[model samples]
Target: MSVAMKGLRNHITPVSKIIITSRSKNIATFGTTEALQLDFLPKEAFWYFFKTIAFGSSNPEEEPKLAAVCMEIAVLMNGSFIGAHVIGGILRSNLSGQFWYTFLEYYRYFTGWYIHLQGEHQSDMFKKRSGLTYIWSYKNWSAVTATFHLYQISSANLNDLPVIRTSELLTRDIKLEGKFDALEWRSSVPPYYSYMVHHEYGTGNNHDVITAIESISFTIDRYYRQHQGVEENLRKLHRMLLRIQAIVEEAHGRQITNQAMLLQLRMVRAVMYRGYYFLDNFRYRTVQAHAQDEVGDRSLGLSPFSQFKRFCFSTRTRKIASEVLDQKELQKMLGHLENIVSDMQEFVAFVSCYPRMSRQPYCSYLLLENCMFGRQIEQEKIINFLLEPNHPSAKGINVLPIIGPGRVGKSTLVEHVCHDERVRKYFSMIVLCSADSIGGGFLTDTGLIKHRNPTSTGQSLVIIELADDDMDDRTWTRILHNLRGEHITPVSKIILTSRSDKIRAFGTTEALHLDFLPKEAFWYFFKTIAFGSRNPEEEPKLASICMEIATLVKGSFMATHVIGGILRSNLSAQFWCRFLKCFRHYTDMHISVLGEHPSDAYTKTSGLTYIWTSRNMSVVAATYSLHQASSAQLADLSPILSNDVLTGDVEPPEKFDALEWRSSIPPYYNYISHYEILAQPPDMLPKRKRSRSLSEGLV
Candidate 1:
């Protein structure tokens, strides 16, 4: 089909339309620009179909009770018209309410049972038992072989999609494997579209870290609600939380693809989310106990209005305090979490830099391309500034700081401007070096370069490049003073590219903040890269998917380029759909790659917050480490591990132990505290005569 589409694209008329339909969305993209989607019938349409068949075209008003039941059954079917048709036939055979009600319950039980069975890996033979055996107890259903017909209908409606129970459907058809008949049978299960890209590879154990934090927060919240003052244990817990937060903040930027790191993260998240799950019950109980106490106080010598005043005032003025459940269950979980965190911190402190790959050196010269988006305006502004030397400076040297978020094409914009014919004619030498390459010896090197070039006194261009958003004002100022002294020429120029605004304070005469691609430009550039010359109108489905991808990235050119590269590898719509499902994880992975670039060296510096920014994403996270560890860089964490940073604190890591806490909670616990808020009447209470303090108004 793809080959056919390729041929058609070459030979077909310019305005001709071609349509192809396939079960696989990937197959639908063959030689197609647009894909038209057909949705399932809406409830109203399904209801009309049900009424005509179930009632033999009779008016539903005559049998309103049956009509109502059918309506409910339709809703339960989840827009499956085929289910309604088969079940409607059964109703036609027996018009009694009991029969219909029994079948409805039977259907629910069958589905739930099937789902439950699929969750386990049972033998194939055990699954093929006749559907009639379950329904044989019911009176008329057995006589008509109703269960057999129901099974047929159910199997026909079921598709291979894992949306509901693919395992059950697959198991039932195990005998027919490899046959053409089996292939047809397999199509019965519908395609599941809501699958998310597995994050195990990308995030590693970050989910565990986050879940643990949530559990701690839940416990802390509960503790404060119960107690009015800070306890020693509570303060200790808070300090531990702050430390964990610091580690997570630092680690969030680093790749967590290591197995050991992932294990630590998983254990921590499990212990925390699990601990919170059990401890949460105590929080509700504590709130309830307090509510009961408040209720008992209402019986004191106070008016109804006064009571209302007290309740409102106390609720408003309530402060969170340090009070935790003394239950061994909670203590056990908290202890486990503390140990996990301790180990995690130790791991973080000891982790070393990823071994650098020996790649070919990058070319000093810029290769400007016409396809580059959002560079024209920036290039022009930078070139105009460089060509005209009217700005005020100490020693005929001007520093223009180009500041913006990461991956905003600051380097590319400046590169294109440097490569311009006019820029080359105006400036003597264009030297681009990473900020890390600059040190105490930079002045001597620049002095040597200046002395060697004694023939020309024209302006020299020095490009100071920084990748990380961490160029400090003091560093920049020192560099500028040293830079001015090294040059023999009266007028020298410096173009500083950094993501931090700290450069602005030192010696920046002018700043150009590169903005992201505007909405129209972003879409145009994205579509061009994703589809190339293919008209999006011809393949609407692919176009739709591209739009979704655009939304996820929020107009990042680098992201757009990365997504385009991934898409170019495979043209299948299914591949594209799957990519879309896991697009966020992929996006993060790419941002991490960008952060590792030599130009963004700000990540290794101390006290600097590293932000992974796209046109739309704001991932500005503050990086921190163990307080004892002098260096904050993840690359230089070896010192921390050898120094016992984890044990240097108050206590040991593994004081608490519990096997039961490791076990997952019961599924039914999902619905324990599901509550609904009811609207109160305006006249429920009289207005208060005076505003009252929380303690003064209490009964």
Candidate 2:
């Protein structure tokens, strides 16, 4: 075919265009010009097309339920025009919603089974232009009488073979005792082709249990020797993690605009974090055990009794180590990491296509600690919204409401977006106003007006930071009115960020909601900060302890830095264990009394919370009524720090100021807390909660 096309192309007139399209890459190479590869249709376009054909003359709006089911079927089609026609024709023949739902259920089952067996969605295979043939063998099901196979074949004589439609296999029960061909699809356009699959039914024997056991025994003997295989697998996983990290770092430095690409990047990041979590947990535990052995050996010298005690301890340690470092588990981890690496082959290739952004020359850890973490998608959305031109038919200024829980980085995201080079270049003047400032008439202030860019007529970007959720509709309207009156340009945009969801209603566009980082992402961020410039593998014991501390910290950005700094300062395992004990006690006590985690209480509500404070070599629980939580410029922060108070280095007065954390990134403000220590009656003292020690299970 390629040779024929090549010869035919040369015979064509100079002005004539010869367009060739094929599913095969080899056939595409025969073209003289660069091949234009087609991707799946955009979701919106596909939905519209699917709706038109599926409903035919019927009104989709009249049957909302059927339309919903049709949408699901359309998604399953994966933008295949052939699939849409076949499935839509089936539904169009019977306009019952129940029938459509039944078809959808069967379709879902077929696709799900394919995904389960092949490790990818059937739709994905369609998108890849892979042949429609898929083989499934029911080896374990006793209900099946014989094995069945599916194949895609092309034949001119359709009447000679027993034909069955793929839909019949899904929608109806058909008994087959012999081989037959299933018609999967038939192209209706030019060069009409038929997609047929051959199904063969036969019996298959199950594996012998004795032989399987022997094989398993051999594998155990080979890989479980002195845990050498486990170590090798760990090394492989570590190398893979490093590769993923390199790609992720490069991606972070680039401006990735494609939504699909961003989603893939996010998946890659998740896999990378999971790999690191497991790797770090295993390596650190091993290192800590070895360190403990060294300490034990030094303490218990060569005396007969000491040697006997050492032997017992070593035996117990080895047992624990064996349980933790199971070779099979290590193999599983390695396999997963390898699979992720394989899947990312294309993602890594395309990551390089994105344009790189100008970044500071700081170390990755430093950058992670100082910059916002795990909100790339949200950041992109904000930037896109800000840079987009106002719709010609739109009225008033554009408002984007960013709503999130307290300390969830809503303000930081806006600050970063405002600082973006594109945003700075697009807006002539950037005005920042707080809820208080708005209420205080800062918009009409003569001093603020005087500082505006008078000569430049470019649009102004107004950023309003609302601290509470109680902003009324009237107030919001007044703010917009005031902006219009002052700026005199409706094109000027406004970004409203608040800790409450109430402000979301005031936005002209969809509100961007911010949430705390997932456990995996937060662990990655915490680990980076906790280890600073040091390699975690070098201080495995500390790394192990840091994971536990991060788990207890409950995704608090302030606690991450504070606790991370404390642990980094003192690398001793003993100190880390002590800190972990204190933290655990703190959280457990709060959970017991308040019925929730202390961090949750701190961030989610403005209520009187019991804070952890130790004194006189014991854990002394102190109650503090949170008066106000506010952000201030670094210079304005109180001298007293929360770390000092928590560590019992300085006992604050009844009512005092304590600095929580100072932001190292844009809009760098010191988060301060004004609280009054509550006096607890002796009779009201909470009972002590007992918990496991770090060394209880392991020697």
Candidate 3:
């Protein structure tokens, strides 16, 4: 082979090429050029090929039932071109649904028996050149009498042997007393190969075959029940959701003075988000399946057998597959949604009673992205505190403290409340004073009066944002003294925001502590914003990937939007998987080194964070000295965006400014961070220890 290839190469011109193909990798070394390894057709292409050949001159759409059966049969073929041709011919010979079902039952049994006997799928067994063994029972016989060994054969005089068709084995007349060669299938394409199996008589009962058939029937029935009327249920769910959304939108347009009604509205909105998530997830199941299959196919040059081993043995893959295949859970979710909608009839009627508040028209998702999320109750509390009237005997101003960790929407919450039409109408002026502004003499009696609205009540609402919790009552007293010199009334109020619990001492009212969103709520929020207008159901695999990403995000809104935007920009499963991998690596790296996740450090305002850049897939350690800064300071910083750095769009300097994210909504603060790229030490821990550390950190 080497000598022949060398002679052929010599005869070929510079522009001309000699192409060679082989099933074995050893043949590649015989060529002078690099070898090109071909992979199995992607699931979509293979399905199209299989169905086209299986149902020649017939429309699959017209025979939906048979087409469905053909899909299962195709899956059983396991990307084998010869298998497709052989099975396709058998199905094409008999167009009857009963005939197809019978063939499927037999095929399913054969594959299952082979797996049981070989400890691997028949596909993998064949790929390894290992003969497949399975018990065969005839329908007319009360017992199993045949044992088969299926294997591929390549010989010069293949036609000289007695050829027995695989379909003939399904009949009662076929009998084998001893081991004999029986042709299983013959390829009609290039490199036409033949598959033959050896058969021998055996003594066994038919119980095992009957049991396998029973199990298969049960699974098929369950699947049927799960998918039956799924389309109609989804349509009904969509319609009910629209109705519920109409009510929710109407409620949002109104100023509901009733606290109970407001709480009910929140419940309705939560259910709405979940229903939509599941609805899209179910509708796009097929798309997600194809995307996931593609991800598996592009496993960095792994062969079909390697991919099969990974699929069967990878714990994570198996778990995800099990979750994705749980049709019962999906059906249950549908019923739950239907029940919630049915229960909302009265709630929907009462939502219209609240007086309307004038607002700009916007889509729900757009409004969510540009406005506050998962903070409706907190926003209402702040607004109520500002709008409440003070007692006649009350001394000094009424103060309410809002405290939370960094980037917990402390400033954004206050901004949204101050912009409320009701609050604006109630207070004569709303002044926002940061800790720096107060210390720098930005707030004064003259400034207060100057900033106050002319056409309004004499009461002023002052919102003070403290940088930390160390501020004492004296500072609050001084601020009040400066405000009291102006046109402050008994109804005047002070709202203090800080990240420390010590600041709560300055407030006369109970401090409202903000926390990260619960897992379910965050998933809903992340899914909504990350998926944007694209229906998540259409890319279930991507949605699932997003779900994992959301968990890693640790409920940080900044991470959600930043990472979500990256994912949303590229809908490709491969890109999303790459991002997921890099994110997980960095997250695990941070935990292994620092005993905490980067998000945990981010919430605490400063720490070491490991970020992965796609540039050569290197890990960079960025020690954050500052978590945020004013939009004014953004002018002095580098033009590099944090996302651009993470995505490897641009290289980062040793020490430079990177804009984390800028809020589009209230406060409109530009979050900037200062980072120095510290050298990452070589991994010294054993592989087992590193994995253990990652698992512990995740927990």
Instruction: Pull out the clashing pairs in model 2.
Output: 147-202, 151-197
| lDDT rank order | 3, 2, 1
Q: Which run of 10 residues does model 3 get worst, by summed lDDT?
A: 298-307
Residue-wise C-alpha lDDT for candidate 2, range 568-600, written one tens digit per residue: 776776666666656655565556545677777
> Candidate 1: misplaced stretches above 4 Å?
1-370, 392-394, 434-457, 486-491, 584-699
lDDT tens digits, residues 219-313, model 3?
Answer: 54554565456556768778887877787777776777677887888788888777766665555434433455578632111123332232222
Candidate 1 lDDT over residue span 114-169, tens digit each: 22323321122123432331111122211111121112324333344232222222
Q: Return the top candidate by lDDT.
A: 3
lDDT of 3: 0.66
Better of 2 and 3 by lDDT: 3
Whole-model lDDT per candidate: 0.43, 0.64, 0.66
Pairs in clash, predicted candidate 3: 280-537, 284-537
Q: TM-score of every model?
A: 0.32, 0.59, 0.62
**lDDT, candidate 1, residue 421?**
53
The best-first sequence of candidates by TM-score reads: 3, 2, 1
